[model samples]
Target: MGDENRTGMTEFYFRPFSSLPKVQLLIFLILLLMYMVSVCGNGTIVLIVCTDCSLHTPMYFFLANLAAMEICYSTIIAPLTLANLTSLRKATISLAGCGIQMFFFIFLGGAGCVLLAFMAYDRYVAICHPLRYTIIMSWTVCVSIVAASLALGFLVSLNMTILIFHLPFCGTNEIYHFFCDIPAILHLLACSNTHAHQVALYICSVINVAIPFLLICFSYAFIVVTILRISSGAGWHRTFSTCSSHLMVVALMYGCSSFIYLRPSSSYSPEQGRVVSVVYTFVTPVLNPLIYSMRNKELKDALSRALGRKVLHQSK
Candidate 1:
């Protein structure tokens, strides 16, 4: 505790991934490949959404933003992690650095949750109320929704970061995981009693994860009802197809995050935490582009057109 008084700063060093000592190199290589692919894939999605005239619609617009978020969120964690892996995980981050990382990560994550719900609502409007979809989801409205999602994300993230970092963090000075996750920081690094903070964090998790998930479910229920009402089987298949990718993403994200955060802090095993963090943090981002592109015909078509234009121009 005197370390803070002496230096006027608190620094948290990352404890090595002790659970897997033998395979850090292999893990590094795999993560590097996955990170590269994720960046490229999501970058392509963003570029396509921006340049392709055919993709200038509400759904694609939301998808572009989602891709951008994945890129940023993953970048914030992956590069530093990869660098630390090279050193076998003796990474030190200052208090301010930790807070900034947490804030942006939570900001992007919170916004993403809300954005997914909005995408569901978008689909609901398109299918359930096609006649008014244009009026309801106009360009101005879409921009406002994005703005609001970001604003809410910013405020919530700011609040959580403030709540956690406001207290004096003293103890082992070692975070067991790669990044300063809320639970890891709260449980492992905090010097004082954090029961109140834990409770507040849990409530925030419910609001961030549960409410949006419920909204998605509600939107889908209407979408399903509307789909079933369609007289033709093809219509049923077509409508459902549009939602499958988003559902997969929702399942992957909500499932992994809920498993980590929504549970009691008593069960926070450093080993388990790191592994699960790998899933939601690294694995999900890499899969997102593949999920959306492989499932959606429009994205693939736009990609092909872009590639063809590049090849032809190069040949010239």
Candidate 2:
């Protein structure tokens, strides 16, 4: 089903991993476990934040949004990846389906990036300016930040998707990577004079990934400075504890994404890109809930209470 037209491309096929069947099987199993964990883990975070009254605050509000984004992010790619791995025949995706996948992948990913930055800001306020933290991070402001993050994410992703898909894919219908990401798609483009397109992609990456990452770092820089100014050892420990989880999440999300998107398309390697993509797309989501739950005692206690209530209701 490899037909090309003047308007747009129709469908695309995915290249199977070059490894042996046993290796493919192992990869499939690992991806399956990762998918389940990402879903369940992020799902639990969302559920606990929603049901637990104690978690009804700006920090947890942003966290719930992040968890929801992670769930959506994993769902967009992981299931299709699993199906492709298990299928006997080569995996094919319709042009419309491919566009949709790319859209959500970028959308949720961008939202998560901004959301993490907001979480850092949240901690910054809570720690560095504890006196006016409540007034500064009111419920109204929190909701506005979330709405802005979602809107900004959609705007950037829409621009990138439109720009990438507008190019003709007349050469090869086979995508070398596991998913329909920008770098992978650009690598398959049969067009000439793609310098402008690549430049636009790099710009988008800079604005979305690199900038937010810098903002997170900036917020934490101030946070660390403010923490050190305090004399109490307990104060230092408490301040650091609040932000450690967010810092870890920022490192994981930005590290892989920046590597994939921040560079020129000429440097794109399908095999390396696929492996690195696994980090942010699959592994990071699974690790996020674990990182947060493990580091945040408040979250752990909230989870316990939520589970306890579930057990109590079921036993009745």
Candidate 3:
């Protein structure tokens, strides 16, 4: 009995549908609504960016890119989470399924971090050195920065997933979070993974959270300095408005990410981690388009034009 209890079965069983209660339908409906809003909001941002030629500037270019990334980022886990919530039959993901989800999650998320850092730098260049902005943010430089961000994201995610999944999950395989996260996955490992795993987690922290954070902080610091240097009060106000939306986004992403990943696992409960993950994973995506695009005068104009065109077509 002791041996059997100590050594969990390789093929884990999930709870049956019959065992679950009826109120889970309410939870499913709420999750579905959240997923729909996230998808629609990000989708609208992509459409608005592509359609508006006036928004072809570097800031809008990166904004579109960020919107695309948000779409991918939310897709990585929202559907699965909603499905799991609704199924009544709380199914268990195979090890391979979990790994694939983990890969996409980290890939898009890490890339977004790097991309946000690049965007901050872009904003800094635009505001701080407006006269030389064109020369500084050349086509080649922009492409290279974006490419580098994507490549770095893929490389880091690949390595982290490989390292994490290679660990033998010989124990009970119930992931606490709605998705596969590093610390949550670590909690289910049968064997002791003390020093080496901690090192890997630390490295992930530096790459995913710390380094990007420092870059964002430094860029914002420069931006604030540059804003203060502007001679006209109107100029200062305009520049500050241009960045406030992005500042809000950076604060949300970094604040949640820092709390979720940077802390010692012992300090928090898995339940708390799940709730925090929702902020960045679901809420951020839903809020981003509303925050960034809705605040912009050009986007509102384009949206109005698009709506008018649709109305005319219907009349025709």
Candidate 4:
């Protein structure tokens, strides 16, 4: 009865969440909380950076950009994922819709990586050459860096998305992973001899993943060496404190990215890939504002003062 034969029928099967039994429910709840947290948390960061006169430095400037990108990045994929968990329908997306999602996801994600690298270079100049920090990280240079990052992000993501979307997805429409990542889409293609597509994937990996990671790595390496050379213990602590939060963010972002995208696509099992994708895509954005706001004294004091003023006005 279950195996009734039909003519020219394409049986669509949804990937089941039953694969991850114990932790599936827990992860879903946490991700829902994260979506709200990242939205509100990053929004507050942007507001404080904009309003506070004293906080208008190179670090906060970059922080504002990072927060903005986190909002964009999380918005692209997290809502759909949460819907898939909560609703009855396993929310199907059309090919065009999937392409649009991939574009913003990659674009904002790429931009975030670039800005983080720039932030590291900012710390490097600030600590290693305090005398020249202001001149080096001038207003013009900061604007240029942010602009270049956004430009490169859009260009690279546009190319990759266009190339991947052009491939005919005639065979199967079901993507195994939770969201519309390139590697996840590749798995659904019915075409044989995908050599050309694989080549494009490799090229994108080099540009979007490999190169930016190397830049981040080199920036931190320089930062560490400079921190070590500081003569006094107090001076060393002061220097390390400045960049430690950024370093934590860098670690989590890069670690999750490497797990999801750096490995051979053949190695990612469907269920495992979805789980790992949740880490970098959903989890990392939620962590960004908390890492910076909690650890950085300036942001905390600014936020507290802003809230206290509001409370006072309300009482009056």
Candidate 5:
């Protein structure tokens, strides 16, 4: 009986839009389409960048990495979310499964934050100091930056996951949000002293989200000043075009993420949190490829040429 009770307590139930049974099918279909588009779009970006010799630069290299990260991030959460949405009864996950989800969610999220900052810095160098751009952002330096971002992301996420999951969950196994996240898990589920865990999460949020966001802001500040000094209108337009897509992505990602993570645990609203998670995890990935491809002529041309080559080969 004791073993049975312990096993029961270790399972978590997810309440995914439980009240909206009338529209559950619509919601599921929409999310499915979004997930498919997100995968295909990010995959195309990675493929185009890898195959096109002309796109073998620091900028496209980082873009491809970001695409891959989005694929992993979305895959970690989307299928589970869809499953829960489609179930007539409440959906449940094992404690171990929840831990895995939380770990990768934080991991990819932190990597993306740092990667965006690096991309901003890349743009700043290319536009602000055109002559020294190649020397400053060489292949070795770019690789090092990507490596550092991944290392930082995994280390921070690992630490947080260990701290949070080490707590005892004695009762109440229902998690209010769609997937297991740090905030929901710490605030709503844990049955022990979470004061220390809350403090640690706040610090992690500062390091992972606040610091990188500020760096991106500072880079753009300098970039704007440099562009203003370029006398020609065409130079101004060209410089703005290069940075616009990245800026849009940064705004969408950081805005949704900050709202979810950068608040006191007491202030967490499960409904609002789930809605924002959908935007950042599902919607943003689909939009990222469109933002980059639609705004940039170079990527469009590369994609067209790559597709055209495939068509010619298939016809032969």
Candidate 6:
């Protein structure tokens, strides 16, 4: 019905949230503050990782890449959202721009999800097979894993974006939420039967979100078993502390993402979706990098040394 009607319809408008100007301004400020925090937090991690030779381990390497991804991931969605919040009623994104946003949104997001699982595996190997940790997680293997994760993420995002924009948008051009979310577009906006599209989305979500989460869980199961066998007394806390940061990140990423993507579009509530999207998009990106670098003693020590060196350079 909408194929021809949608041919020239190359723009999508974002609907306003709060009718009150004060409320909109408040939201904008808060979002901007959080976005800045996310950028600095992730940016610090990247800087320290690259500068500090002590943090050149595989885990920190992955952490640096993950931080870089968060910085980019949030930038992809947050600025546009902040702008929308300020304007309140009149914000429009071109069709191509929207598709590009969706592509990187999924690419970085899916890659980050998979990278978490790999980090879990790194913990697993270091704990379960301590003697072979070096061999098992070789630099070559880590780089390859990261490369594969990105390639796979890119391919999946490309396919999803193409399928989505290919649909006819002959009807309402108003998006109910901040960005071009898959369900928001597929269910509410696309003027076509989305049975096949929904199925594809569901399958990808399972592969990207569910499967990686399960893998993390599986790896952690072995990690717990191995930790219990080797440590007791005060050793228990010390042994588990290394993984606690990662586990928290896993919980946050999977919990919010699953809530957002792991369901049928028929049950998608626009209000609820926007609220939850804030968590994974804004909150997690801020917290994940902080927890990894800020909370880790080794990274902290490295940062201290870097600061010491910086101060010495300035003094000299």
lDDT of 1 by residue, 128-242 (tens): 9999999999999999888888998899899999888876666578888898799888877777789999998888888889899999999999888888789998897788779
> Over the stretch 1-316, how does candidate 5's per-residue lDDT look in tens digits?
1343355567898876757876888889998999999999999999999999999999999999999999999999999999988888888998778889999999998999899999999998998898999999999999999999999999999999888877777657888888998877877877778999989988888888899899999999999899889999999888888999999999999888889888777888888887888899889999999999999889999999998999999999
Write candidate 2's Cα lDDT for 102-161 as tens digits. 998988898889888888889989988889999999999999999999998899899888
Model 2: how far residue 152 lies from native, Å:
0.7
lDDT value for model 3: 0.78
Kindly report which residue pairs in candidate 1 clash with one another: none
Note each model's CA RMSD in angstroms: 2.1, 2.1, 3.8, 4.9, 2.3, 1.8
Off by over 4 Å in 6: 1-6, 232-234
10 residues in a row with least lDDT, candidate 1: 1-10
lDDT of 3 by residue, 134-225 (tens): 99998788888878888988998898888776666665556667888777777655355555776787788789778988998899999989
Model 3 stretches astray by more than 4 angstroms: 1-23
Candidate 6 per-residue C-alpha lDDT over 149-241 given as tens digits, one digit per residue, 9 for 90 to 100 = 898789889999988888887677889888988988886787778899989998889878999999998999998888778646666776677
Clashes of each: 0, 0, 0, 0, 0, 0
Task: Give per-model TM-scores.
Answer: 0.95, 0.95, 0.91, 0.90, 0.95, 0.96
Between candidates 3 and 4, the one scoring higher on lDDT is 4
Candidate 4 clashing pairs, residues 3+ apart or interchain: none
Against the reference, the lDDT scores of all candidates come to 0.88, 0.87, 0.78, 0.79, 0.89, 0.87
Pairs in steric clash, model 6: none
State, as a TM-score between 0 and 1, how close model 3 is to the true structure.
0.91
lDDT of 2: 0.87
